[model samples]
Structure formats: structure tokens, C-alpha cells
Target: MSYALTLEEMTPALRVLRLIAAECAHLPAPFVHLTPIEPERLELSLHDVDLTGDTFNVFELWREALGIDPDQVTFRVQGNGRTRVLRATGPYGGADVTLTAYADAPAAVTTTTGGAA
Candidate 1:
């Protein structure tokens, strides 16, 4: 089996969303939503986060590791910092996924970020 969407087909923002969601799937509660809030803005919501854990902020790490610009994205962490939902606008389009399904059969997309590949 293969992913319906390929790495070459995803935009930079979409790839970031998928990467973060996959990265945080190991948390007590994993990411479950990736929705578009506007024409160019997208949001990713997680079910839980480890506040006391050193991995609370996956944004900076993923952002830096992926080289995503701050101007293109924003984040809203709720539930006493135990839950986080990242928002990005610019390149992500119509990228929404179920954490369980995705984690089970994740799309084979390259981690490379920025520009055309």
C-alpha cells in the first residue's frame, strides 16, 4: 500500500504539518487534526503535550530542524500547556489527516523543506 499523496505533491507547509504530527505521535495524546483556517492558513491540533517534559515545544525544534520561517506560521497551545495546535499560512493547502490512520499508514514524503525539489 502507498499514500494517496506523495512528497513531490505536498507543499512546504503541508509537509511541516505532517512532520510535526508524526513527531508528536509518541506523546500520551497525539495530533489529530490538520485544518485550514483560511485561504492560506492551516492549523494542527494535538490531543496532549508533556508540560514538564523537555519536549513541550515541538515547534521551535521542528521549525528549526525543518527551516520554516516564523512569519509563515504561528501556534496556539492550550489545555494548561498540555495541548498544542500549530497554525501555518502560506503553502499548506487542504492537508487534513487522522492521527491514528496516518500513524498506521503514513505517507512516504521526504523531510526536505523549502523551495521546489
Candidate 2:
């Protein structure tokens, strides 16, 4: 599967995914992937995340990475799966970022932020 994400529209969650992926570059292929399900969501995954020497939760890191308010993003874990769905929104733009395992195929990650226009 593939996600339609532009660099200009990259969200904090997306940036976090990129940072994690780059940091874990020593891993094998398909270690990480980011996909835009709709205008509001993106998908990401890594085989493993080293929590060593980290003082912030995923949301905090994402917030700092994206330079957005924590309220602008919401995270949800789908069932008992390893995937994580991040719903992000702002005055500029919004997106969903999903992080899961390589074995699990990408899903239709979608989101909508703010009140209806």
C-alpha cells in the first residue's frame, strides 16, 4: 500500500514517524511507512521502539516534534493490536498517523479535525 503525503503538508506525527524511522535505520526493510488515508490521517509502523532514555510519551514527543499543541492531536490504539492511530488537526491542516507492525497490512486511516466549515 502507499500513502499520499506531501512534504509541505507533513504533520508532527509524520515528522515523528520519520524521526523514529531514521533513528532505527539499522533495521530491515519495511521497518517504517507513512501513508495518508484521507486528508486527516497517516499510517506508520516499526518492528520495535526502544523506549530507553525517553522521558516523554508518544503524544508528547509527537507534539514537540510537530511544534503543535497537544490538544491538536489525539492518539488511539486499535483493539489489542500494535497499531496506533493519531488524529491531528490545526488551523492550517489535519491528518491521521497510524503506526503498526510490518506483518499487518496498512488500513484506511482517516480523520477530521475542527468544526465543520
Candidate 3:
């Protein structure tokens, strides 16, 4: 999957991730961790997740934190099956990141008969 986001979009995306990280930091053990490997990219890993909040909440929180128009930033998700593409848009910059749910192919199925027919 591929995406095209502007610099403006990237600002809020990063902000939201940071906010989430901060909130989780207070927890005894957080489910997700965000590590910035590059200036424009972050790595998010989840150990446990709470589904109490929806994606919109994240977007709103990001908007409030970044002091930007909620509509200015947009996030999109797309993929074929296991892999997904997430794109964020903002004023300063935008970024696209791909997430693979299953990095390896599924194991093949086999049929058994009386012996090995």
C-alpha cells in the first residue's frame, strides 16, 4: 500500500502518537510504544491495547494538542489483506507508513488419507 500526505498532515500525526505515548507512559505497563527512528517517521508496537476509545478520539486529541484545524489533518487506512497503509496529512508535512499484520505467509494445509495416499 502507498499514500501521499503533506507536511501539514505529518505534524499532527506525530503529535497524536506522542500524546498517546505520554498518556501510556503513566500506566504501569503500556500496550503501545512509539520510537522515532527518523525525523519523519515513528515505530509503534503494541503489547496490549484498550479499545475504550475510538480513532476519532485520537484525531481530536491530536488536533487539540497541535492547535490545528481538525479538518486540516486526515488519516486514511488501506490494504490488500494482512498489510495496511496509514497516511496522515497536515500543514508542516505529511507521511505515509505501511504496517504488515502478518509478515510471513500462512502455512500450507495438507490432506491425510489412510496412510499417505
Q: lDDT winner among the candidates?
A: 2
lDDT digits (tens) for residues 1-117 of candidate 2: 666567656565465555645764454333334445453444443333434422124434443444556666555666566455554443212344443332222466768889885
C-alpha RMSD for every candidate: 18.6, 15.0, 10.9
- Per-prediction backbone clash count: 0, 8, 11
C-alpha TM-scores of all predictions: 0.30, 0.30, 0.29
Query: Comparing 2 and 3 by TM-score, which wins?
Result: 2
lDDT of 3 by residue, 10-40 (tens): 5644765566457545432222222333335
Evaluated against the true structure, the overall lDDT of model 1 is 0.42
Candidate 3 stretches greater than 4 Å from native:
1-50, 81-117
Candidate 1: where is the Cα deviation over 4 Å? Answer: 1-30, 34-43, 51-56, 75-86, 90-117
lDDT score for residue 82 of model 1: 43
Model 1 earns a TM-score of: 0.30
Q: Residue 24 error for model 3, in Å?
A: 11
